[model samples]
Target chain A: MLLVILELVGIAVFAASGALAAVRARLDVFGVTVLALATALGGGVIRDVLLGVHPPTSLTKWPYLLVPALTGLLVFSFHPQVARLRRAVQLLDAIGLGLFVTGGTSTALALGAPPYTACLIGMTTGIGGGAMRDVLLREIPLVLRREIYAVAALLGCLVVAGGSVLGLPEGPVALAGSALVVAVRLLALWRRWNAPVAHGLDA
Target chain B: MLLVILELVGIAVFAASGALAAVRARLDVFGVTVLALATALGGGVIRDVLLGVHPPTSLTKWPYLLVPALTGLLVFSFHPQVARLRRAVQLLDAIGLGLFVTGGTSTALALGAPPYTACLIGMTTGIGGGAMRDVLLREIPLVLRREIYAVAALLGCLVVAGGSVLGLPEGPVALAGSALVVAVRLLALWRRWNAPVAHGLDA
Candidate 1:
């Protein structure tokens, strides 16, 4: 299916970002692969576990592991080419984020998740890997502190859900949803937008 | 009651180690507390989640959070005194490791886990926090290499299981197991001992 191809492309992009980050941090080959695996599959693993699906999609399939490992290895071998196009990497990352959020939302919805829960899962699926990567790297996560990260995922989820409720075809719905998320993220990054900082008594 | 005390002591010692490591890592106050919390309670959290226990014990008990947070704050304020005796910290860490392994193994056994699974859980309970810390710090885990490491936990689990099958009182059995692990780790450290390495396979 076209959707499946899009999903795989998204995964490859996400995994490459993880590998690139590890390389930038001076991690070895093993570490690069580990980070890529975590970044590409971490969100889905958490979602599956919470949904009570044992063995998870990653463990149930070989491509899930092989793809990320290969992506990391490839990125590591060709770091110079990738490093020169930082902007291109960011654009790909945003596109991957959009695709993943749509996939996660629709998957949860099809599995009979409540709307709010589906929305949460979708957002978590979109940003969870990046959060895990940042935590492991001892850095404040950019999504949590800087941009409209989870918000973009949520918007994508809303668009997909809205289209589904109107009996739209999944392909167009997913495409629209992904485009919305990618556009919002690109705009937010360009404008240096951020969520409001909480005051001393906010909590 | 003694076992409970030992568990609490283990938590406290690990909390201290977490705080010290956070300080050394140059984290902020909140970051220090977060590190301390993960170091002190992360193993139990993973155990409870894997066992399908809802609202893990660490969340149910306020002291579990309070103690580690307070420990981090204290260390943040008085780093000089704590840093003066690094050996004392190492000793406490070893004692905590013994208690954690013994406690986790017995808990798993009591919960009807198989012996090998119980032993694995025991090792995880003892070193899970440090492993998490290392992973988060973007390095190979110390537990995976160097010193006696997981061997201490494995030996302790054997003792605990053997004593339990022999109808020994839980108290004496746990105490003996804990002592054995502490002694093994101490002697190993004193002799600069390590598990055998396969050439070209350290990675």
Candidate 2:
């Protein structure tokens, strides 16, 4: 029950990012809604698909679909106000990243994937929605280019996976893992830390 | 049996496009290979996932992974020569588009998806790889921006779906659908046909 609430909150934050992007692109309402849905659900959908869950929860569950759809419309109408709240959204986004990575890792673990694969899948689930949104908006994925996003997700996923391997309690471990991700992500953003580019590529 | 052969050929063609794009982007050998694999296998993997097939054939089957990896290496080594063969690649790409849509539709139908959902899946399967490639390359997908790509795929998918509805034989209908996609794609290229953009968004 708590996890579901976290997931919904994460979806709404992710959807806001997507909706704002679409608005900046001046997309029509339909396009904004579509992009919002894709950004909010793409990661979970990808994770579920990898786990062989048919008609993924995002597709079948009403709340999973509804939150993003409604959020998109709200953002579309009040984009200026929403844009002014960027800092708040970013904080929420960090929390969402933590939730998604930990949630995704444990879900994959429970669904029978090995630890390594679960870690990879969990990382993908944490990053996939933003990647899809960037693709739709015609930008190279920020995660692939500059952000510490995937690494942060991986760290959290590893914590979750390690807990399972050591037969530790899942709940405490998950909370710890989520905290690790949130801390790492917020620190990275505050410090403006970024991954390095390949050396001498254009030199 | 023939379908498998056709699928392999289609994957190779799609991989080539991805490799060429990666080469143009001046990505490293590993990056080129990664993009090729994503482009070649993304659609089928997505289809399989939606159908509840765990460890999608793209992941489980060595040959499926091998073809694109090898193709990427080959292109990376001889990109100039490969670039000169653009026309040939375009022709093969049309064929690939045909095979993917028809095959994707039938596979979904066989997997018990309703026809409407199957048609959407099939069209997605046909266009998904190219869309992914463009995203990785940091460009608007040609299919979304200027090409008649998705419509061509949809036409083929609808034929497959309609054939099933009308009680026509699968094999012949699939053949006809593939031919239709190929013909439409080639013709659109020759004629410089394009879909209209939304009116006066920035005008």
| Fnat scores for every prediction | 0.03, 0.30
State TM-scores per candidate: 0.59, 0.62
**Best-matching candidate per TM-score:** 2
lDDT digits (tens) for residues A15-52 of candidate 2: 99999999999999999999999999999988887887
C-alpha DockQ of every model: 0.07, 0.19
Q: In candidate 1, how many Å is residue B131 off?
A: 6.8
lDDT (Cα, tens digit) per residue for candidate 1, span A2-87: 87778778888889998887777666565576678778987776776676553355544657767888998888777778877989
Candidate 1 chain A: 10-residue stretch with minimal lDDT: A53-62
| Every model's TM-score on chain B | 0.92, 0.96
Residue A26, model 2: Cα distance from true site in angstroms: 1.4
| Clashing residue pairs in candidate 2 (N, C-alpha, C atoms within 3 angstroms) | none
